[model samples]
Target: MYIEKIQSPANLKQLDLKALKVVADETRKAVLNRVSKHGGHVGPNLGFVEATVALHYVFNTPTDKLVFDVSHQSYPHKVLTGRVSGFLGDMEAMDAVSGYSSPTECPEYDNFEVGHTSTSVSLATGLQKARDIRGTKENIVVVIGDGSLSGGEAFEGMDEASELGTGIIIIVNDNEMSIAENHGGIYKNLRALRESKGTCEHNWFKAWGFEYKYLEEGNDVEKLIEVFRSVKDTDKPTIVHIHTEKGHGFAPAVENKEAWHYSMPFNVENGSSLEGPEHESYDQLLSDWMLQEMKKDKTLIAVTSGTPTAAGFTAEKRKQAGKQHVDVGIAEEQAAAMVSGMAKGGLRPVWTVVSTFLQRAYDQIAQDLCINSNPAVINVTGGGVLWMNDITHICLFDIPMLCSIPNLIYLAPTTCEEYFAMLRWAILQDKKPIAIRIPTNGVNHTTEAVDAAYGYEPKYKMVHRGSKVAIIAAGSFYQKGENVVRLLADKGIDATLINPRYLNAVDADTLDSLMTDHQLVVTLEDGCKDGGFGERIASYYGPTEMKVLVGGVKKDLYDRFDLQQLLSDNRLLDEQIVEDVMRSL
Candidate 1:
């Protein structure tokens, strides 16, 4: 096969347009085979196969750097860069490479380890500046999607790139979708440009001073090569806008682009999921609750930053929401600030986002929401150690980042009852900006139904009271605390077990009271130890006689770590906690 012969982009350079098309076909099959078995970004890889192949054939990559916006669309790029074996060979081979582009795996091929969207233009601009400084004339290209263009960072970078007046090729891949359908006014202009065949006076790229070129047939390798050849070795900033199908060459993905954007292991023949039925998730619960609440309150709104599916807001639910559902495509910063405005305007705004993505809006949370004291409910879903072991998507840092922000109440709920109660309180209370870290594991109803009317009092709930030792657990780690309590009881050491629901602030009164009977106070959190819930508790008891032991993952980037092994390494096991307490005593 042509794909097997392609060891690198250098090999791709040797191939003609016809041979390149053959390689693209082979790459698409490999992507489909690997993605269907192991699960990955199916539609993006399939859509961008020809574009990727054409770019590698025309550009001298590794010298002429190429950066992908989200890197979810980098599967085709990986195949061309001597990594086809990972996709085409064995099932285990797919595990050898990450879903996103990683410099660690192949420094020569992948320039950045990017998972977030709208970052390529900014990243590639930096590379261009660095090359200019080094007196190098190599090209710098950034491939960004239409959906990602809605982000503020992309505009900021594009604005700067226009002024540079150097050789920078900005390829705008207009696939007409993000993870879901594209949102924002920019998409409207994109549609106009597509309809007018790039002759529209309201040219978004041209307004930014970029020399614009558009291709009607983006999936055509010959057309893409012609477009690339026009801008090759040019000494001016240019944008090559190519209109391509999102899920090209795949009928199922093309018909339902959003659902096929990313998928679990599926039956290749029918495109049906191979995994069993999905359990009821916190996302679904939040969505259902919001729908019910919206019926009661007209001013209630559900907000998401491009990723509506993450919050379980299906297209049907979004349609039902009508004017109440707000999707500010790929703009987390805007979403945070907008929700703050909505709260100030006497509206109940609930902004649900993935924990990792919310990090981008830290400044917005601190300045726009917390400083103004807006009663906005930010539901941080996927806030702990996730099974998906990618460094860029890790949800560990949310606890530390959110907790440090002043006037922002960060709550950790262990069970569905607590989560619902916290959500209810946050939505109803007009006191301060609140963020609730949604439980990651399956639903556990250990505790009774929480009182919705009860105001948040920054107090830890004592599950079991005992003398000598007190174990304080945060959110999902509460189960571990219960297990430790059981193990302590078996050893005749009846320890006190406490669940510190409020992660940001300490319940000083309750903690001080524990000092009378408890000799040791142990704090456990399913996040980074540095600046996390455990550290706050440790600081609270610093001057006191009570010894504090903080148990959590270390302050480091944990890449694809086994969750159980990570817990054991941190001495979070029941036996280990019991042994440590015994030794301290």
Candidate 2:
């Protein structure tokens, strides 16, 4: 195959336009096959296949640094750069490489380990500055999507790049989608530029002082090669805005772009998912409840920052929400601030976001929401260790970060009922900023209704009361506490189990009461040991007679760890906790 013959960009440079097109076709097929077998980013990879081939054919990589924004489109680049086996070969070979570009995989090929959006321009700018500092003449190119332009960081980078004067090429891959349909006025400008053939009166790129070039046929390898070659050794910073169809070759993916943006393992014949039906997720529960709540209250608003689907505010739901749903495209900082403003303006604003992405708006969450005590509900999904084990997306730090902020109520709901109850309570109350850590495990509902009157008071539920040993499990780890209780029962040792629903503040009265009956109070949390919920309990009982043992994952970056092993390592298992408690006693 043409793809197998090309080991690197050097080999790609040897291929003619026809041969390059052949390689692109083969590479797309390989990507399709691999993603269909083992879930991955299908649409972005498929759309950028020819562009990736054209790039390698034109530019000298390794020396000439190429940075991809978010790197979701790096699959084709990987296939071209001596990693064809990763996609074309067995499932094991595909597992060898990550979905996103990683420096650890190949420093020469993938310059950065990127998964977040709107960062390439800034990162490439840094590379250009470093090259200039050392007096090197390497060309710095950043491939960013039209969707990423809405981010404030991308704008900052572009503003800085314009000042660099030389050796920077910004390739705008206009696919007209940001995980879902694109948001903001920039997309309208992009549509205008594409319609006018890049000769529009109000060009955003041109206004930013960039030498602009437009490519109508971004999928055409020859045209892409010509465009890339033109800007290869350019002295000034330029923007090559290329219009490409997302999910280009695949029919089903083309028809449903959002669903195929990133996919689970699917049938190659019909594009049907190989995986079973999705369990009733926390996001779904939140969405269903919100729709019902919105019927009753018109002042309620649902917000997301580019990733509306992640929060289960799908296209259909967004339409049903009408003016209530807001997508602040790839701008988490702006979303947080906007939600805060909405709350301040007497609207019940609920911003549903992934925990990792919400970290971007830490300052906004602290200053805009918590400081003013805006009654904004931040529903954080994908909390704690998840099945998808990428280090960049690990959400173990949300507890420490959110709980630390003053006037912010951080609740950890163990069951679906509690989650819904907390959501309802957070929305109805106009006291403080509330964040609910959505459980990773599938739905677990209880018949008992959660207290709707739950306010700013630090109240903890004592599940079982016993002398000598007390287990204070935080959030979803309440089930672990139940298991520990059973394990202790098997050993003929009676242990008290407490569910600390609120992480921001400990129930001091209940904790003080524990000191009278309990000798050892063990705290269980699913997040990092340092600066987390467990530490607060440990700190509270430090001066007391009760000895506190904080159980949690270590304060370190653990990438792609076995979930069971991670639990075992942290003494999160019943047996491990039982053993620890025995040792402590």
Candidate 3:
């Protein structure tokens, strides 16, 4: 009732301290309740609730633009900025307030819709510069995470903002960690500054010529409001270090901040989620596989760009794994070049990056690593927008898009078992930079995968047969496409379906035969439809009479989506594909 009554930030500012604190508490409770029912980034958003409230309450919004880093934590901002119901309805939020900041999708969201860590500071800085050029007078406050500070984009923006000496508020929400615990040289500096009683003067920001204000007590809402009000009228770039416990008020997440950074449905009373076994993550598998390889082959090292945890590489394992475990801060470009050196120095370096984030290192993957034929094993995980949190096209369509290059080799696995085998094969073999764009469940973990060279399978490895049209599937989405086959057979439309295990490596003979004999070729992949393997395959059948229907994703998934609706939008359903096939026939 109180939430509904407060329509705007002006109304929120009118609330007394007791009401303000109560509002903050209720907002937290509401956010936790919403995200827990259908899992979202809980910790980062939770940590910034009070500070976010304080900023909006003190400043004017819509007119006074507030940008969020990666914007996963913008739920509170959405709730305060004329979006009362934006934070609710997890299942419905897909078409509404996205998990990330999306202005194009929704009017309430700002210009940037980001999920990848960092890049906010740069965006805010550019917007501020443009505003100044146009003689527009509105406050620009960009909230960046401590984890994102490790990224080069944030630094570049911060450095540029410092030079411009413009009045922009850079709120550094220092809860720490980028998906997992942050890795690199800067995290150490942050720890020192946090512990130094203000003695640790490693001024990374001042070095760039920005005014700095360090306040480690982010939980104290009153103090935060005062600090925000103090910098409200300042005329140069200013940094506010607001320290808050991630997963604050929740004991479980506070204790193991790394693991509790996000969670699924749970009992809110005890703060314990549904218990489950600790299945291995891609990071853990790669670390374990690397350790085993180091035992056999001494020249092995590992490299990561800030996200060791997302990849499942624990700190202990990184230390104990092999000859070298390099955490190159938030710089993917730097990490790319480092791997090349390791390869030339007679050491095999493996880089484990999530498929979506690997796009940052494309030039390096091509020029620095691929041009030299460096043996770097890039372990990419979380490839598709299967879940509701379709923030952006983190899709791996680009990796396969880069297949036009000369030397690089790409691979994919159906289950967790093959991941180890793939890793072993990648490590032992000498080739140009090898990027294995892995789906979440890359290998079947049961079998002990050893280094055995295997031929790259076609994008669609036909596993079943039917009298009707053939279905082609790629990436982790084969599971869904496989189900469609069963669903079709239940309707008496027995169809042939194949898993394109190697998204990049097309099976020439199998593809040719399928195109000729099959009534329809329905191609499906998780990446963007344009410049993907399916489109390439479609192009390969140049000016053909065969009816070919392609499905996956268009490019950027819009604000609202339903599975059936998405399929309808893409013409992916049986009826659509069959109708198109009929027209071609």
Q: For this target, which candidate reaches the highest lDDT against the unseen true structure?
A: 1
Candidate 2, residues 77-152: lDDT per residue as tens digits?
9988888898888878878878887888878889888888889999999998999899988889899988888888
Assess each prediction's global lDDT (C-alpha) against the native. Answer: 0.89, 0.87, 0.71
- Give candidate 1's error at residue 380 in angstroms: 0.3
Worst 10 residues of 1 by lDDT: 446-455
Rank by lDDT, descending? Answer: 1, 2, 3
lDDT of 1 by residue, 350-385 (tens): 999988899899999999999999999998888777
Please list the residue runs of candidate 2 whose C-alpha ends up more than 4 Å from where it truly belongs after superposition.
none
lDDT per residue (tens digit) for residues 548-573 in model 3: 67776787645435557876777766
- The residue ranges of model 3 lying beyond 4 angstroms of the native Cα positions read 86-95, 104-111, 197-199, 275-291, 314-325, 393-396, 416-419, 440-451, 454-472, 477-501, 505-522, 543-548, 571-585
Pairs of residues clashing in candidate 1: none
Arranged by TM-score, best first: 2, 1, 3
Where is model 1 more than 4 Å wrong at Cα?
A: 454-457
